[model samples]
Target: MSDDRSPSTPPAAEALTRCDALVLGAGQAGGPLARALTDAGRRVVLVEATHVGGTCVNEGCTPTKTMIASARVAHLARRAGEYGVHAGKVHVDFPAVQARKDEVVAQFRSGNEQGLTEAGVEVVMGRARFTGPHAVQVALPDGTHRAFEAPLVFINTGARPTWPDLPGLQDVDALDSTGLLGLKERPEKLLILGGGPVALEFAQAFARFGSDVTVLERGERLLEREDEDVAAALTEALTADGVTVLCGHQALEARRAEGGLSLRVRGPKGEKTLHGTHLLVAVGRTPNTDDLGLDAAGVEVDDHGHICVNDDLLTGVDGVYALGDVRGGPAYTHAAYDDYRIVRDALLHGTHRSWRDRLVPYTVFTDPELARIGLDEQGAHEQERPARVYTLPMSKVARATETGETRGLIRAVVEASTDRLLGATVLGAGGGELLSVLQVALHGGLTAADLREGIFSHPTWSEALNNLFMQDPVEVPGAQERNDPR
Candidate 1:
């Protein structure tokens, strides 16, 4: 008798194709989540309108770091004479530096694309708008429409530079951060508006690259988010770098000047004109949530257009999630990566750790990188916690002395009674690397005594923390004796 289910019979292979997850805006978070889900035996569809890698790779961090490296080399070559080295005359070839940056970006983009393809994630290059809670309509390049439906949908469209509502500024033809990085030719002079990390970084970079740089801020000081002393130190560094920084200059109007652009800025004294070959507007960034039909999908957005996400990274709509810059948290790549973990756990495992468990650390990649993690003095004070502040100048650090980069300080804020590490600030050559120690101390729940007791390698910049915590409390002038530095 011939059996239907024989060994030679073809197996059940032709199953219906449907995705378990659909991720929009393939950036750091979305791209990795897609790969992780696919590895967990879930079918994933990752969609991107532009390149596979998002802004950070294509136009943000990668390009900025490349340009900064070029600037750093140029800076060192200029100062080689002071180090007892006879270096030849140096000239900055702007076009050549830009070309090198473009080469690096292109290689990274190609790698991102190749990785996505190899991961078996369907990378649809088109603008996708949510047509329903579980459905997305993608506008393909060939003028065709493709509808994808998945039970789990993730939005990670990231952010763009926000243009403010200053009158006539929109028609002034100014450049944002993205446009400024793509310039093949360097301007003779540049006028930058705002005093955040982007503004400060670009100001120093352009000045080093031989452009007469001027930064105009509406606030009372530069880098207002940092401590007053930290901002003052940075201001001094920028002034020494030949950047004409004008704080409290509220930009009123922008118009064409003699062969350039003129900005009418108002301050306490009066209105004055600031001229430049080009204007770089680095006010802030806004989430790219608009035009994506998030409202139709029942996803709630804050007043600033950022998607409202819970601690679990879930949107108001079930099975819909938002992460990265779109979620309106610390807009850093590492934070986005952590967000990926939270979403991945919620989707793949039974674990229930919230994104709030991660303490965010930030670093502004300047000459002396400004890095911070945990709460600062202000944050601790606001929480009504009795705090103690300690700081060590880089000039006293053995490593910084040997490296000739002793131009900053390391500061820590700790609870007086509990000794729990509250926050830290480091401004020095290895500020980025130094932040890791503070991050571990904050997240690992290590106290001041714990850090002071730890055996760190000698002659390292990080020894500053150990030295800082070992110091005696501030001495009272009238009632107490002076205590020496440990």
Candidate 2:
């Protein structure tokens, strides 16, 4: 039979929804943007192919952090004697932990859905593809199709785990971040094939859960984006927790072992086969722009499949924009939400708010946590910017000594001429929270002297900044110090 459906024609009026704004994905950006646009008395349609809240709420932050908390509790319980409390045999109930994580995820997802419904935004559960510059054809869940048209459209489809085309990798069973989170049973031995933030975080969590974990990283160190000292500190922390880290190693092949899975790895020591009960591939993430029909809409994507957006988050197509992980740049949920704000300001208020030169801060939820803001010591040196470097061991922080969590250190890079805080890294307990102090200070154009002499409360992690900035400048190799203001 000849096909009767015409691809160019728009759907009938009854089967099409025309709105002032259309949001492609109900992710971090889409959800809030949809609500804001709807509240502004504009008809908005928000479509989500999967669950709401995107990666942060569903698979990435909420679920993983919930389980990580449970793992932390288990670790603390085992270390009860260190705190002068005699707590016997700490047991980890894997199923119970998974259940709690599920509960948390469901609650957050439900809350997001309810909020969208209450905001008078039309929430469509379907996959969206651009049929024209200003129109999309949605494959609805009910085995039906609908078309949506709007002058303003926002794409926030986010990203997914990138599966590399390594030989035998696809044949053997491997878990990504999402699959690892859904695990109900504790793996006896876990083999992770990356040393980035996600890989290290999961490595620590699983190790604390009593799993013999080994991390194989292709780069020279874990968290390669950070300075070498920072990466070494994290490596030390992980090693102290019984994680076998193999840096400068590449996964040559994967095969089914007798009991579990076997990974052939090649490093400086030569090829070695590692066996594990579970294998997790936490290499990286790729934007979900493959099936978006971006070409039809005249929206361009970069080499990595990330939608190319201008500084204002525009996708080159008029009234169309990209946000969050799908638009590349910083793949944090906060960055995505900020993209929404930038777009909102441009479209709603007609203001030109650029998404450039903004300070981006992030944290890795390891045992002591690793948090950073702005440039690192290496970045300053590479840029040939003269700066004063300061390093303070966690042992110097009273809170770290008292808490017995002094495994990491704090490092700060400050411009010598201006005394302005160029960057800071907090690697001790509550590092993410403590990094915020420096973040605020830097954002307000505060200098190292300001932080050094600030009256910070004693016996707290934040107080470490006082000692960090007070230390005399240490000359780093290949770094020329500008004239010190002091």
Top TM-score: which candidate number? 2
Model 2, span 114-150: residue lDDT tens: 9999999999999998988899999878867889999
Q: If scored against the real structure, what TM-score would every candidate get? A: 0.92, 0.96
- Clash totals for all models, in order? 0, 0
**Number of the top candidate by lDDT?**
2
The C-alpha lDDT values of all candidates are 0.84, 0.88
Residue 363, model 2: lDDT of: 93
Residue 479 Cα positional deviation in candidate 1, in Å, after optimal superposition: 23
Query: How does residue 242 of candidate 2 score in lDDT?
Result: 90
Error of 2 at 459 (Å): 1.8
State, as a TM-score between 0 and 1, how close model 1 is to the true structure: 0.92
Lowest-scoring 10 consecutive residues by lDDT in candidate 1?
A: 474-483
